[model samples]
Target: MLAALIRQAQQAGLSPEPGFAPKELHWLAQLHSGKFTGVLPLREGKKGRQVARCPELSQPEMMALPRVLGQTQAAHFLADSCGVIALLPERAGQEVDAKTQAKHGAYAALLERAAQDLPQLLPVLEVLRNPAELAELRAELAQRGAKATDRLSFAVDGLDLLESELWYDWWRRFRRQVFGQPTTTGTMLDLSSGEVVTPAKTHPKLNKLGVGAMPTGASLIGYDKEAFSSYGLQAGENGAVSEENAAAYRAALEHLLAQAPVLGQMKVAVWFDHRQAEGQALIDAIENPATLTQASETFSWDDWDDTEAIQIVQTPEQQAAVAHTRAQQLLSALRRGETPPTLTAQYFALAISGASGRAMVRDWHTGSLEQLAEAVATWFEDLAITNLSGKRAKRPRFFSLLMNIQRPKPQSTSMDDYLKPIRNLQLPLWRAALDPNAPIPFSAVAKLMEAHKAQVMTGQFSEALSRDGDGEDKSRIYTRMALLKAYHNRKARRQLARGQGGFLMSSSVDPHHPSPAYHCGRLMYLLANVQDAQGSDVNAGVVQRYYGAASSTPALVLGRLTRLSQHHLAKIAREKPGLALTLERDIAAVWSALGHALPKTLSLEEQSLFALGYYQQLADSVSRRQDLAAQRKAAAAQADPHPATSPLAETTQTEQTAQGE
Candidate 1:
């Protein structure tokens, strides 16, 4: 039986590759089992070679060579090379031609049946018969004839056909296969009443079996040639019945409508139009009456005067009022922790005759109708129920008031206008606290206090107070001066407590005790500080004056002068006072100190500020003395001419004495 099977497979165009012959049916059995593996020689041109040891033979290629050669001498040669025992030709129940014809008839019948209900089934059936799947199908069909007629059986057959390797091979061959060729290895056949008509030899590239061609044996089974030609399918053109398809498609549409409540007490009507026109159908088979009515009406903006065709529900004035009321209500609801509901249209219509015409009812529901009603309700409910007992809401305090005072009003007249009125009034008092004798200029003091207050309020005073001279030397000097002035005020208050009232003494020339060297050093430091503040090189006279003054004065006075000069220089530097007057005063102070012994080790630059200070002091003293002399001369002129020289002088002396006391 196995030998007979092999013979039948051979005659039916089955063969194996070289170096793959059967031994006791091993090669034939292995080939049928799909497990045999070997190389097959392939050569171009006329070079003969062993079929084994070929570089280009894939496993499928090797397996297919024998099948292609069939029971011919080529099959025997290929089988010999592969070392497989060849099956000799033997009658296997029927002649090859007869068997081939029967298979073709079967295929033709399958194609006809596929074309009737589902033309998609033909390609699937072609797959089943290519690789001996017909045998299994035939056996299965024979055992279950009733089951084979069911849709599930067709699905199973389709899946099995797709899974088979023969399916892909047959699909390729079907595209290339020709009719009336005896050697064509496909099952498609023609069954006709007339003699088997031979096809004429035309262009090899022409696809005669394609749709719309004359009905050859292969084409006649699944399609009508006459009808295809009339429809232009055979003319290699598209059919002109697309509108018909659309009409048919539209007739099969289904409409879905939803009616739901949106908000708490309003109804929502939603109409979904899913109807489609199939083929050439102009109208949707399943359209809603309301939508169709609306679509049929023509609208024109210029037809407002046609009152019978255009009725107004709410006039423009009424609409504005309604909109305003709605806005107010929405605001009130938000304030009262309530969710606002949406307002939807009450009616819809075809505006054919007038806007007042009764609308067609498409869908209707009496329920809640707000867009975000649920979301709004949830938000308000969450807010009302949240537990916020221990959470402290921040409130403004005294510090906020202070900050508000310092902040400048936008349209101020000047710096004075910008400063708080009370702060401006306190400037003199602040300066008096620093030094009674060295009362700062009111404007300069106010500016300084404002800056200091800003720095303090910003929490920068402590850090500024702590920093010494690093790279920022000028800032260090300013910080030191501010601290020292603060210290001097404290010391003066302490002195006043002890009844030693010298708080108003001149910082330049006080003579009670030997002044400390640190005082002279501080004065020299201040001169340098001021010069640096002015962005200028040091002048010698300025340094000399301070050094000489420090040498003559008591330590207390020296210390006071040091602190005072530092404060005053910082003030002057920041204020940029009139330099002429300042320079004169400084020069006069240096000149007055010149009456004392000078330091031998003083540098020329160090002597310059002192010289300048002496000149300045002299100029001021002369100016004052000259003014006094002029006043006396004027008084004498105003007196009686050459009269009462002795008695008048005595009366004047008595009055001066009483006034001085």
Candidate 2:
């Protein structure tokens, strides 16, 4: 991994050379002929900042300045604060302590010492030694509203001292004497020249502890405690990796993180071995496969450059189909014995979280891009389930799938607390999406089930089945059913691996399914429908009253509901015999499918099947109702082709004749 990272950084033309790193300097200290002129802000609001190849020393470099509690070593170059430059007391109005005074002297002394070798540093040293000039520096900063803590670097005669090679070499030698020798060793792929090289022997010890652009104290390879030390290794001696390799790896990771997709507190860095892969495209393909399929038909290579032709394709989606279609085409080329641009490249992903101060690597994934695409395609296929319209429902985005498990927020709960479960499930769920054979986490299914049951308890069934303007059935409910189906499909896959057959849930209701719990769920929905058909407003109907009991202890509640359903059926028979008979037949079909006796109590898995069966039955019934209504309308239209001269018009004429008589 470290070798790969070093290669990546070198290939990107980023110099990961030891003893030097990129730092953003906030202010530029203008100087002329050994005299302080003024300070200028490197960046204003919404403006770019100046970056310098500053000298970095130590594992975790000291902030503000390079000084310890009692030690008075000045920051060699690039002090981050006025306090370091002027030796300001720790607090305002406080007297300068002896240690601070020593640091002040050391700051000038280091420059004086460096000036001997690099004559260009002599002017900067002269300004640092003058008290009046230091006071003028403070006054200039105060006028510009610059805080004492802002980072600033010096410039003399249009020459940035930090960017000077002479200063860099001087600082490198000083760092070597203070810190120990560089221990980096081993052959690594030199991405720059595309050859293997020993960077340890060629580069200096210049690695710093941090993840991205910001330098952090937290370490991924720190041995701060005695217990962490072993094999004759002492504390602070990170024997696992040399500083040079670590720096290269850090630079590579930082590059990846700069463009990685983020989920909650985690940032996922995805890349191809040869080139950078569009991570969002992979995520979108998994989240909404149908959209990619639709986009492919209209996506043209020519339209890419025609702004007017592709004007509708803008931010976020931003011609998303291009990536998806191109990826598929590349994969197709490989299968057809043609050389594809991205043929046979491996996909790499690393998910990391730095919320705990220490950097934590949550997951590392690697696979052929072909396998990744197949896995994502398989994920959507397994999750296929019908909507309330009895059509295949849209797959929710990956984030939406996780969000479905979150409990309804209470007024007192913080957003962070409410989203904790979703955050916890991100890594496992992401892994599942990437691995076709991996099962959806059982804990995730359980949480979703709990949420589903809670919605039932609160009489949310009607809302779940409600139609939206886009003709989509209730999205949250559809997501729930899809997740349930996926859970069962994965379980079946594992069971097949074990040489056993298991029930697999389909996209729509299957009346021939053998599970009594499923049929019971179907019966539950049918009974609820019968009660609703009575045309009476009941505060709490069958689903709200009996769902929990029926889903858990089917034997106890289903039989009672079946008996009560007869009364509702009888009322419907008196008013609409055809509808009553249809309901009766539907109930009989569900009972016929239940070949086994109803279990006394359901296991968690069985309960999920029950919910799936219930939702699918409802969706099928809705489709039937829609089809029946459309059929009736068509029949009426056929029966009276000449609607303007029909029975109603004749009846009105007869009534007028009677009035005349």
lDDT of 2 by residue, 535-639 (tens): 221224677888999999998988887888899889877776777888888888887788536779999989998998898888888776655555554565588
Kindly list the per-residue Cα lDDT of model 1 for residues 598-621, writing each as its tens digit: 343433222222222222222233
Candidate 1, which segments miss by more than 4 Å at Cα? Answer: 1-417, 420-491, 495-503, 506-623, 631-661
Model 2 residue runs over 4 Å out of place are: 24-52, 60-76, 79-167, 177-215, 228-230, 235-240, 278-280, 283-294, 298-321, 328-343, 355-357, 390-394, 419-424, 464-474, 534-540, 623-661
Worst 10 residues of 1 by lDDT: 274-283
How does candidate 1 score on lDDT?
0.28
Total backbone clashes of model 2?
A: 1
- RMSD (Cα, Å) for all candidates, in order, is 40.7, 8.1
Worst lDDT 10-window in candidate 2: 201-210
Which model scores highest in TM-score?
2
Candidate 2 clashing pairs? 19-206
Per-candidate Cα lDDT values, in order, are 0.28, 0.66
